[model samples]
Target: MPLVALVVAALAIGFEQLIQWKYGPMGIIAFIALTIGLKAKNTAISGLGAIILVMLLAQSN
Candidate 1:
């Protein structure tokens, strides 16, 4: 269980780093908004963040 958790954490960190490298501060901001919105149980904010992230990723490719 602990090893699984560790692997998940590591993968998450790596993805965050990849986003940071590819998209810079806007990526971080969108991620934070998504996380906070989810934690707060607000669909509107989370949706906005998700949209921003999707747009950013789409824009790149």
Candidate 2:
């Protein structure tokens, strides 16, 4: 499931890049993806998603 995790993580990153921000739907999706990944026992997915999510939230006003 590492591959799947990577894919999901990639999608989150793509969404962040697509919207050019992570404060809206992009952030929400990333968080959801993280939750799903962790729940599925894919630490890689959770790690990657958390990194992006943290970055996004940290930068938020």
lDDT of 2 by residue, 1-61 (tens): 9999999999967865664453777677677778788899999888877887888878875
Q: How does each model score on TM-score?
A: 0.83, 0.55
The models' CA-based lDDT, in order, is: 0.90, 0.77
Worst 10 residues of 2 by lDDT: 15-24
Candidate 1 per-residue lDDT, tens place, 1-61, comes to: 9999999999989988988899999997898788889999999889988998999999999
Q: Which residue pairs overlap in candidate 1's backbone?
A: none
Residue 7, model 2: lDDT of 100
Residue 48, candidate 2: Cα error in Å is 1.6
- Candidate RMSDs in Å, in order, are 1.3, 8.8
Off by over 4 Å in 1: none
Q: Which parts of model 2 have CA positions greater than 4 angstroms off?
A: 1-22
